[model samples]
Target: MKHVTKADGGRQPFDPEKVQRTLRKMGVGAEDAERIAGEIAESVPDGVRTAAVLRMIRARAKAVHPAVSHRTNLRRALGLLRSKPDFEEFVRVLLREHGYQVETGCVLAGRCGEHEVDAVAEKDGTTVFVEVKHHVSHHRVTGLDEGRIARAIIEDLQEGFRSGRCVVAIDGALIVCNTKLSEHAKRYATCRGIGHIGWDYPEERNLRTMIEETQSYPITIVAGVSRSVSTRLAAAGVVTAKQIAYGDATTIAHDADIPLKEVLLIAGRARAILEA
Candidate 1:
């Protein structure tokens, strides 16, 4: 077995099983899967960076199929929203784009106490308290604690209703995360009618689908955009591709300290993705 350096710089023997599983999950056909597996086996060097391996997989997958590749890449970008504040803002932007009015870090006084909700989404006369659980480590799974958090939000909703803090009736509580939820947590949420939107949930309409439908790719997804560029873009209040697409490239270039030509290229790519 060849040793591969992981993202944390730890070295471990490569697992071929992981390649097959990921290929299947990415919706690659068996024939294509075998070909991709062969390519991976040939391309990966001993002590190759895990991030490089992921890039290779995505590149090879894209060569095999564009639609599936986009789906896989969407999942990757969604998982990268690891920072708590960034993830919360992402959810707010997503909901707002879907026509919901959103507010974040809202503090409301319940009859029992004051509750701080990560986000509040309202649409069509319905209001929901959204609790965001963001984990930097993609391997971590959200568990029973999520259900507990949802239940707590529900309690706050109940008390807020009594205190007139909530003029309208609370519709439901939602748990949104950039990671997977444990089976027990999923069961608990379902039993309580609590909504969930993890990185990959509701098989058909997960976070990937949500972003694709809205054409709201994160700034981090832009080709040739580095972490520093993305951070600068975010600091300038431009978090999504849609935001960049609609804004002036010259101003963005000056503000982000990126060359105007490169900014134009990025904007073009963003528009192309949206049109695609």
Candidate 2:
């Protein structure tokens, strides 16, 4: 069996099923996904980078639908929230989708000093400090240092809670990020009991899984929204594609100061993704 290089520098036997499954995840039909996967597996050179395969898949997606092509590049769509503020808002929305009541830009009391956290999510008598780790480049990864650093902060918060300095009892910590998590980071998180959800970490429940369950994709994933426009939408508190699909285009345009026509086009794209 031939192998293709994975994004994380690992290589595995080329599985057309894996390719088809991913296409289905992105809302491609079963027949189309299988056909595309078969074509790629037959023609792609051995050891081709997964990124190259994605490009070929995307090129094929153009025949399916332009928005489908864009959706296949979900990582890039996610990177649209590359800035800290935008990514933070995105994490907040995602947590809400998971049934957590969220508050952003919170100041939390800690043993060392008061710390400003990106978000605080509380549910069913449990409170978690949520940190948004945004890597601007796809090549960058969330590593052990990230888990270590977050653990340190949470420990301090736990201390504060014990001392009655923090209002809410500190329970645990969670890191939500767009990048891949390193193996060491995953191990450390498991050992330390730090909750983490990245693009492809925690095999059972990662960011992609959460997004698919709720169709809670960020506005950046909307096909026509450029990075600049996405930033504008985020600034206006318009973060998710689900939001655009459910809102009136005129209202969203007026509030974000974007042209209505642009919002309409963007809205149609969002609807296509959510409904596909």
Candidate 3:
């Protein structure tokens, strides 16, 4: 057996071109083989053995296409974002418009301890704690599962309300999820003296109407003045920063003649200002 050695006495073949050809034969593409060969040749120790260099080359080739793997991961992440319950901030804005003093992102007691409540709303003489869930699938969630979650939320709220641990008065309670779960949950909630509001899908008219009725004010004040001021204000009654932040951008774009991207940009800027 002949031993190959580099000029520096490294016990390995120094021909990167040969390594690249070997990689190409092992199913690696020409471009990827070139990249892998360069990395291995440049980084491997001069004194390393030929067997070690070969092993390193093989491992590098396998790990080099990580970006390709990331595409699928990114797609899954975007899907989750699209279906996130808090994406629209629906419950938060609805309560604000309806003249209910609202506190968002508050943790409430649950059967298991502390469960986060999306919004706690208090009106003239009644108060309600709301939990919002977003479900994107076409299949509806049965009341059995959703009802249990709702019941746990309501029970936690009731416990807190009775102890006077929080400032808001609890005259009622509600759980708001996708429209599919609304009917079933409503029946269960109503039986227990808890309220349930269903918003099936995004509808400009329905959202506008809800905002108007809840806020006791016109849409113009809720949604900022923009190029499509009159139409958008009339259609959605979005008059305030809070309402605009919570309203659906897709609906706003369709009715207001403003691009969805533009609406989002404006909303992002507005949110930044509000946070500051």
Candidate 4:
């Protein structure tokens, strides 16, 4: 008949020394096994729980294996293996490396209701909403049209304003589409005070360029109005054209928000004068 220690569901009397010896035989050192046994003893009540003690012993044994322990810790840190979740995790990691407090899974207002924004990064008190789109086929993207996508992005921006978060409040809202934005779409976004970023190649390449560009020209004004509106209003108060150009819109808007369409109309009038 085989003898089993009481601590491990055996018939033999429970002995901490014997447990340590068994642990050493199983590739755990004496010091580690004793330390783990002490922890188990402290965790349990006066009565010995064989199952719990054995579980502790097993756990300690595994912890001594550096590679196994590292892999285990990594798995725990990474959570589950969902595709979007994994991508978001990588994006947050990259953002944090660049000194941003990045929050994943942000909900932004869409044309219908709620849209899941992939990430929202904040730095120096400014927030940036980012949308990430992934595509598997180059041929599919090469042949497809971008008109609908551009329209959707514009509508989303309109909804974002209605939700009380203007593009000015956000440093920028970026749509990282797998395909590049068409020239017409880019102009449309520029006209509406939104920014578009494209990822025609690998995502890494696109992200690198986007980060560099964002760092270089860090400030973008999405005020519903243009520089001309401020210039005209400032001129009434004896402010120079240069001073109005440099002044902030919110300071100039004063009581009411300037409509972007009105700003565009004023810009057209200025362009007509310049042409003449």
Candidate 5:
């Protein structure tokens, strides 16, 4: 009916079509999404916060099935991860889903310095040195300064390869981040020939779109997936819900060294999230 307050305290005119699009992205049928968006637009007050609208939408999603809410609960789940180590692992798994062979925690010597890479990803014989920037806050943005740093890193890595200081052959550099990118960041990355993936940048190929399309949600998306459980699973290279949903339960259970029953419960929850 009026402007909706964003999480960052900015306001935007309430549009039911936008809500419907979000619902459809979350896998609500087109007819249902339209109906639900219409209902919210009519019922909500002028000053309602966007968070409140999402809560109302989530309630409706859960009415269809408890797991339906998980489809769009990615924001909260990703924010819960311990940013550095956990986020790096999550991105590694996401890259794997997109057909990249990823190696994490790689250290390479540059012409002037040594840089620690979040991942070295290869696909179709092309390799990239990936730098992962993770933000716990929903409102934080990946800015141009981050791009500047990444560009320098890429330049150094290129020099290292040319001079035979770095053993691995790298074709380019990429920045993988959990939040949206600033306009300057996008421009800089493009001008410098650096590949970038942000939450909603690059439109069709952004991180959020890729996650939904590949169904490569982090293991933490499951309810009650404690730090201990995730740590154990990560030790066995199980970082995504898709891995749990499709992997052999017995093997995963043994490899993670957690009980079979617990693994089944986790797998069951992962399956529910995917199939919701």
Candidate 6:
């Protein structure tokens, strides 16, 4: 196999088995996975991009199973959550779907001091205070600063727990980020019983799995759409692709001042993607 360049500019030998394995992980049957791998191997030339290969596999998988495409490409969709405020809103939606009532950017007084909580969540008699650490890109990894963040959060939780902010008592202090956590931080959180929800934490209930479960795909998932346009759409309060799909394109165009033709196309693509 020839070497292929990755999106991060690293080079590695192309492996069709990797494609098949990913497909299988997405619930594709063995025969179909092998067939898809064969097609990708034949289609991709030497020196092709790994990202391009992924896009090809996603496209082909979408033809067979829609969830496969959405699940596989979710990290890219989530990377579109460029701003801290937007990431918070995305978390709100996610929590809401998970049956948690959420409040964002609230200040709670602890026994030691006042702490600004990123989000406060309540579900089934449990109250959770969340501190969101959002990154603009996947290149950033949280919890890499020698457990400084984890230690600080644990300390905050201690004060909050002592203060008795919740009538039923505080359940846990959760740190949710749009990227991964460092091993040290993970260990720290685990030891302290702090909940860490990263892009791929909690195994089954990661951000990608949650998004797929709720079908709340973000606007960034639509291919061929520029980040500028998606950012503008998010600014206009259209954060999810499902919103664009179910909404009126004309109204969106008039409000956002985007051309009606382009708005329609974006909505069409979103509808097709979610429907497939």
Write down the lDDT of every candidate, Cα atoms only.
Answer: 0.74, 0.83, 0.53, 0.46, 0.84, 0.75
Q: What overall lDDT, based on C-alpha atoms, would model 2 receive against the true structure?
A: 0.83
User: Model 4, stretches more than 4 Å misplaced?
Assistant: 1-83, 109-112, 138-172, 200-276
lDDT of 4: 0.46
RMSD of 1: 5.4
Relative to the true structure, candidate 4 has a C-alpha RMSD (angstroms) of 24.2
In model 1, the runs with Cα more than 4 Å from the true position are 1-57, 61-72, 165-168, 254-262
- lDDT value, residue 3 of candidate 6: 74
TM-score of each: 0.72, 0.91, 0.42, 0.33, 0.91, 0.76
For candidate 3, give the lDDT of residue 203.
42
Tens digit of per-residue lDDT, candidate 3, span 82-166: 2333323544656666576888767765434666666777777677777665554323453546557766666665677677654
**Candidate 5, 1-276: lDDT as tens digits:** 388998878889999998888776666788888889989999999878999999888787566547774444686677767776777888988888899999877998889999998889999999998988888885788898877887788788889989999888888888988888999899888998889999888998998888888988988888788888888888888888989888999999999999999999888888988887
Candidate 2, 14-60: lDDT as tens digits: 88998898777777789999999999999999899888887787778
* Runs off by more than 4 Å, candidate 6: 1-18, 21-32, 41-49, 55-72, 144-154, 157-169, 248-261
**Candidates ranked, most accurate by lDDT first:** 5, 2, 6, 1, 3, 4
Better of 4 and 6 by lDDT: 6
Residue by residue across 104-175, what tens digits does model 6's lDDT show? 767766556666777888988877777777776776778745345545654666667666752325567777
For candidate 4, which ten residues in a row score worst on lDDT? Answer: 215-224
- Across residues 158-208, which tens digit of lDDT does each residue of candidate 1 receive? 778877985545678878777778899889988998888877786776666
Q: When superposed on Cα atoms, how far off is each prediction in RMSD? A: 5.4, 2.0, 19.9, 24.2, 2.0, 4.3
lDDT-best of 1 and 2: 2
